[model samples]
Target chain A: SQLAEENSWALSVHEGESVTVNCSYKTSITALQWYRQKSGKGPAQLILIRSNEREKRNGRLRATLDTSSQSSSLSITATRCEDTAVYFCAGMGYKLTFGTGTSLLVDP
Target chain B: EAAVTQSPRNKVTVTGGNVTLSCRQTNSHNYMYWYRQDTGHGLRLIHYSYGAGNLQIGDVPDGYKATRTTQEDFFLLLELASPSQTSLYFCASSDPRWGGRAEQFFGPGTRLTVL
Candidate 1:
C-alpha cells in the first residue's frame, strides 16, 4: 500500500518555468525523501527533509515538509527538458514506502 | 562513488519456473533493499537486510523470498514464478551511519517477465 498521495499523475510545464509537486501522507514519519526516475531507469534521490526541518534545497529542487499536516511539496525552478521524469515522495519508517508518483514533462 | 548493480538486466521465465534476482552494492552500505515497480503502483518493498545473513520482511513479501549472503550481496528468489509477479525490480543500498537520514542509491533495475 502507498503511504502518500501525489497531487497529479502527469504534469506538463514549459522549459524555464517553475513547477511544484505536492504529496500528502497518512502517517507520522521520521523523514520524507523525494526521488526522480527517468525513463528506463531506477529512481534517484532528490532531497531528504527530516521531520525536524521544514525545508531543504538541492540546486533547483526545493522540498518542504509539514508534519502537522502530514504533507510535503517539491518545487523545481527553471525547469529543463532533462528534468522531465516521474517524481516520487517516500515516507521513512523502518523502511521507505513510496507514493504513486507525479510524472513531470518539461517541454522546450 | 556509490553504486548498486543487479542482474540479469532482463529475464523471461515461465510459470512454476525457478527465478533468482541478484543485487550487489559496492558502497559498503549496511542496509540493502529490494522493491518491485508496477504501472499504477509506485514501488513496493519486498525485503531488506541490515547486514550479512540478516533478513527483514517488507510490506509486499508474499510469493517472494530473500537472502543476504554478504554485506554487499543480496538475492531474491521466486520458487514458483507467476505472471502476476512480472514487474521491474530495483535494488537499493543505504548507510544508517549518516545521522539516520541516509538517502538510498538504486540500481538501473531488472525487468522480469513471468509468462
Candidate 2:
C-alpha cells in the first residue's frame, strides 16, 4: 500500500483558474513536501510544510498541512499553461513515501 | 549550484545483459537515493545510502543492487536485465537533518529500456 495517496489522477483547468490538489497519508510524518514534475523531468520540490505548521506559501503556490486529519493540500493561484505538470505530495521522516500524484493541465 | 547528474541518460539493452547506471552528486550531501518512476505508480524508492560505503533497502528493492563507493557517487546495478525494470531512474542527494539541511536535489534522470 502507498503511504501517501493523492485524491485525483488528473485535473484540467483553463488558464487564470485556481486549482487545488489533495493528498492523504497512512502514517505520521515529520514533514510533508509538495513536488512538481514536468514532462520528461524528475520531480522538483515545491513546498515543505512541517507537521506543526498549518500553511505555507511560495509565490503562486500555497500548501496546507493537517496533521490531525493526515492530509494536505496544494493550491495554485491564477494557473497558467506553464504551471501544467504532475504534482505529488510526499511524506518524509526516516524515509520518504510519495503518492501516485495529480496531473494538472492548465489550458490556455 | 548543487547538482546531481546521471550518466547514460538513455539506454537500450537486451534481456540478461548486465547494466550499470551511474550517479554523481556535487553537493557532497550525506544521503543519496535511487528511485524509479512509472506511469501510474509515480516514484518508488529502490535504495538509499547515508554515506560512503553504506547501503539501505527501500520499499522496492527486489532484483536490484546498489553500491555507494564514495561520498560523491552512487551506482545502481542490474545483473540480469529484465523488461520489468524498464523505467525512468532518478538519483537524488540530500543533506540529512544531522547535516542540518532539509532539501533533496534530483538529477536529470536516466531512461532505460530493456528488450
Candidate 3:
C-alpha cells in the first residue's frame, strides 16, 4: 500500500500548454518533493515545498502544499515535449514515501 | 551534483536463484537507500543505511537483505528470487544531517526479471 498517491493516473496536453498534477498523503510530513522520471531513467527532483511554506517555485515549475488537506500540487507552465514524464510527489516523513506518479505526455 | 551508479543495468534469474544488486556513490553522503518500482507501486523502499556496517529496514523489506560494506558501496541480496521481485530497482544517497529534508540523489536504475 502507498502512503502517498497521485490523484490522476495520466494527463495529456499540447506543447506550450499548462498542466497540473495533484497528490494526497496519509501522514504528516516535514516537506514534500516533486520528481520527474523520463523513459528508462531514474527520477530527478524538480521542486521541494516545506510544511511551513504554502508554495515554492523553480523556473517554470511551481509546487503548492496544503497541510490542512494533506495535499499538494505541481504545476508546469509553457510545457515542452521534454516535460513528457511521470510526475511523483514524495512525502518526507521519518522516511520518504512516494506516490504511484502521474504520467504526463506533452505532444507537439 | 552527486554521483550514484548501479551495476548490471538489467538482470534475469529463476525462482530460488541468487541475485545481488550493487550500488556505489561517489559523493560522500552519510545515507544510502534501495527501492523497488512496479507498475502500480511507484517506489517502495527496500532498505537503507546510515553508514558502513549499518542497515535499516525500510517499508517493504520482505525477501530482501542489504549490506553496507563501505561508505561508498551498498548491496541488496535476493537469495531466493521470486516473480514478484521482478521490477525496476534504484539506489539513492543523501546526507542524514538534513534529516527528512535531505534530498536523495538516484542512480540510473536496474531492471530485474525472475522466472
Off by over 4 Å in 3: none
Task: Assess each prediction's global lDDT (C-alpha) against the native.
Answer: 0.92, 0.91, 0.94
Clashing pairs in 1: none
Error of 3 at B42 (Å): 0.8
Question: Where in model 1 is the C-alpha error above 4 Å?
Answer: B98-101
How do the residues A1-108 of candidate 3 rate in per-residue lDDT, one tens digit apiece?
Answer: 677899999999999999999999999999999999999999999998999999999999999999999999999999999999999999998888999999999999
User: Compared with the true structure, what per-residue lDDT tens digits does model 3 show for residues B23-103?
Assistant: 999989889999999998899999999999999999889999999999999999999999999999999998767863478
lDDT (tens digit, per residue) of candidate 1 on B12-115: 99999999999999988989999999988999889988899989898889999999999999999999999999999999999869632368899999999999
| Model 2, position B101: C-alpha lDDT score | 28
Relative to the unseen true structure, what is the C-alpha lDDT of residue B93 in candidate 2, on a scale of 0 to 100? 88
Q: Worst 10-residue stretch by lDDT in candidate 2 chain B? A: B95-104
Q: Between the candidate structures 1 and 3, which one is better when assessed by TM-score? A: 3
Q: Give per-residue CA lDDT, model 1, range A29-90, as digits (tens).
A: 89999999999998999999999999999999999999999999999999999999999999
Q: What fraction of the true interface does each of the listed models get right, in terms of native contacts kept?
A: 0.68, 0.54, 0.63
DockQ of 1: 0.67
- Report the TM-score of candidate 3, chain A only: 0.98
lDDT of 2 by residue, A16-61 (tens): 9999999999897889999999987778899999999999999999
